[model samples]
Target: MARYARSERESLADLLLALGPDAPTIDEGWVARDLAAHLVIRDRRPDAGAGVILPPLRDYGERIRLAATRRPYPELVDQVRRPPWWSPVSNRLVDELTNTMEFYIHHEDLRRAQPDWQPRQLPAELQAALWRQVGPLARMSLRRVPGRLLVQSPGYGEFSAGSRGEVARLVGAPGELALFLFGRQRVARVQLVGSPALAERLRTARLGF
Candidate 1:
């Protein structure tokens, strides 16, 4: 099987190098170098990666990630491209399962941020893989949201998310839906359908980890 995770990681690394360290990304204040450092730290430094999900470790993780940015930009991109074999998340056995959507989303974080950038025509298999991730992502990110959310990717599938309330629907491709749920609502190409008030709220709600 093709390794989408590996492909996305390589592509992201290439873009980082091509754009140099100063290019902007969809990730708010982060530039290419910062995004590269984040990937390196998340993949290679388990102690700091914990901060991604653990509240108390967040400060420590940010410090480590920020420190990583001072390294040569190419070196940081290389670390992202070729993660250490011993790294927990990127180890051979689990890298596919853990990084497919992670790398894809971050890749787009860089790609979509550039002016005149357009979406890639992804392979159908890759789209299927991304679709599978939507459920868990929505469940996690929308748990606290105040209305019923119906997420639809025509030709793939659809599912309801969020806590119970009036129904609102988000329509987009699998990758776009993933981006929306990951807090890139401003950049994600999704259409909202429902009451104007509820739709606006969902669009602006804090999402992702």
Candidate 2:
């Protein structure tokens, strides 16, 4: 027989519960507040058991950029569930698996504000997922720019370091690194990897909310 949820899916809720009150979040976009609202609102909807909010649930990446360019933070947070988010062009069907992704995605945003940034100790499965996403993204990022160091985000334990010994260091708790790699630390700090360049790329990169 099939179960409604698997161990992997069940772990995400445990992960969310593990997050502290002060995780990193987007600065101008009410990223944390919106995430909080999403968690609260979506969970309440009996129809959507897992409360998945995919990137597709958001505005076109372009639209989010345009909106970020024009809107005030107060208004932006207020608009969380309205337009763009629920719009057909962006919303994608998702379940708990996708829901877990959202938690990681949004948590990264929150990590920026947290200086003593720490990625919660992920269960083995989620830890594995974090490892999988970081390398490809980091390699692609380095090709476009330059950074001569590697860091192990806290909590997850050190998995890999591309190369070592640069003038600067990529340092932070595991969650912070995970969040930064995923592009949410734009509004927060990932401690530092090498230069302001790392943070700058994160800020300038056209990552959508």
Candidate 3:
């Protein structure tokens, strides 16, 4: 995890760069713009004429992204060691960990938008960084497969086999779930086995912006 403030803007930026210019273009835009704007919201960057704005996702992601961008990583760590941005008001380590998770989670999200997308396992170092989120993402990734809730991923396994209560399926590689939750995507492309209400709820979970 980070010892600095806010989310991982560098990592998010790196991921957008990795997505390349040829990636899928959503009705809103390509994954690149979506990813960038999402992080921008987390950082609370002044909305200086960036065309269309994105919906809100999680504040933590935006915060870290902006914090990371203003200075070099070394400087960021220094900021963490100083005052104003660090205190009981906010534990530096905890904030860094969440920001790390946001980065790791969203990396997968943007990556999954491509037909050729594939996720390397969450890197051990990054995992160590966002280690706390594994359990939480695992639980959140699960969908109630048979109960009118189904999660379908492109190349991954089918979750729940369309039976039983809630299903925590990992159908479309982990990366898909990462981007999906990060709100880089619209749910229309993803089929839901449950009621329209369930789909609506998932759509509106609002991962910040």
Candidate 4:
């Protein structure tokens, strides 16, 4: 079976290597080397990865990530390219579940950072897969927004988000909307419609994890 996660993982690895360690990425304050180390720590260190989402463990996660970032760049990128088979996050059974969207998002984080970057034509299946992810993600990420949030991915489908007040509709491909909702607004090509002020508010609102 085709695995988008693995394909993205390998592609991202190759890109990082070609760009070298000093290249820029969409992640603020992180260059390619920093992003590479993040990937490694995220998958190989379950304890540290939890810190990515768990506030109490954030300090520990940051400590481990800092150590990983200190390793030689090439070596760090290689580890991201070929994760150990026995690894909890990289093992076959869990890899797809844990990494599909993770890799996709980070891959774009690299791609969109470059000056000449352009959106790739994604396969229908992959778009659908991405659509599925942004559904729940939009709900959670936009929960704090003071208006009704509707995310529309043309041809695939759409989902409702936010809790109350005026309704704001966001239109774009799944990948684009996902990036926008995740705070990649500078790079994500999405259209926001509804109240002008509220729309701007949603656009400028601190989004993503």
After superposition, candidate 1 runs with Cα above 4 Å error:
none
Global Cα RMSD, each model: 0.8, 9.7, 9.2, 1.2
Deviation in Å, model 4, residue 173 alpha carbon: 0.9
Candidate 3 residue 30 C-alpha distance from true site, Å: 5.0
* Candidate 4 lDDT tens digits, 36-75: 9989988789899889779999999989998998999989
- What TM-score would each prediction reach against the true structure? 0.98, 0.41, 0.41, 0.95
Better of 2 and 4 by lDDT: 4
Tens-digit lDDT track of model 2 for 1-209: 22212332334333333453333346455544344444434433323323233544344432334434244433434343232345322233433333444455554455535566554554656655655556555555454333354556655544433333343455664444555555554533467644676546544553322
The numbered model that scores best in lDDT is 1
Per-residue lDDT of candidate 1, residues 119-172 (tens digit)? 898999998999999899999999888889999999999899888879999999
Give, for candidate 3, the lowest lDDT window spanning 10 residues.
Answer: 43-52
Off by over 4 Å in 4: none
Worst 10 residues of 2 by lDDT: 1-10
Model 3 C-alpha RMSD vs. true structure (Å) is 9.2
